[model samples]
Target: MDKIISNKEKSYLAVTLSGDNDKEVIKQMASALEEEGYVKDTFADAIVKRESIYPTGLPVGEINVAIPHTDPEHVNNAAVCLGILDKPVTFNVMGMEGETTEVSLLFMLSIKHKEDQMGMLQKLISLCQDQNTLKEILAKDQDKINEVMTALVEK
Candidate 1:
């Protein structure tokens, strides 16, 4: 599975973030990936810029989530970060032009290839849409979240 979840001291896969705004949240996620060498230093800025244009927020079932990512050029290693916010932050809705939603969970992706990016996106969106899965994820700690996501990634 290529260790899709990181186990470094500053865990990247599943962690609680307390960024007060969308930009801050995205930056925090990017910083964690960068710290682990999963992404280039440019990743943080790139993702922030990308999110401004193509918002990835979705209001699925009960909870709202966001999937923020950037071009493959900014990624050094492919990995997904799951950030559970202490409080929800407002994010622009995907394809909804000017609409927005409050997102409490975020999946920040660092994909090294465009093709893989699409596949991962599809899988993540599908997983996020399941209310039960989302609830389970939110209820667990970092280690358990890693188990859940690792299982999901392997599938």
Candidate 2:
């Protein structure tokens, strides 16, 4: 796989929201990305809209994860902002409406090019499917998380 995410891009890793729900968590993550200049001012609202229409939640191994992203027009740069929720939040399963999963991880993608989204998503799915890899990611600190994710995306 090509390295779609660089170390600077992976620098947005965070552990967030034990007390908040899915919408709140998404807002928080979007705020961070926006502050970092990875996304545009309208990014948060766009993310909410996109996720509402096409939920990104997926059941990967024993853990549930979400890959929330909006159209490239809402992005200023390319990056992957990761959030590890302190507790699981419910997100409707992707491709399966009326069903939900408790999502603990979020991969908020900020890609400036529409063409790169699917490729980035494929690499993310590959990373999410590995139980050992997810465990390693969950156990690491922010710096370590960046290292782990960068390695995974690069490979």
The 0-to-1 C-alpha lDDT of every candidate, in the order given, reads 0.81, 0.76
Residue 14 Cα positional deviation in candidate 1, in Å, after optimal superposition: 1.3
Each prediction's total of clashing residue pairs, residues at least 3 apart in sequence or on different chains, is 0, 0
Top of the candidates by TM-score: 1
TM-score of model 1 relative to the true fold? 0.88
Q: After TM-score superposition, what is the CA distance of residue 19 in candidate 1 from its true location, in Å?
A: 1.7
Determine which window of 10 residues in candidate 1 has minimal summed lDDT.
1-10
For candidate 2, write residues 18-102 as lDDT tens digits. Answer: 5356788888888878877788999999999899999999987677899999998898887777777777899988999888898
Off by over 4 Å in 1: 1-5, 8-12, 141-144
10 residues in a row with least lDDT, candidate 2: 1-10
What C-alpha lDDT does candidate 1 achieve relative to the native structure?
A: 0.81
lDDT of 2 at 43: 96
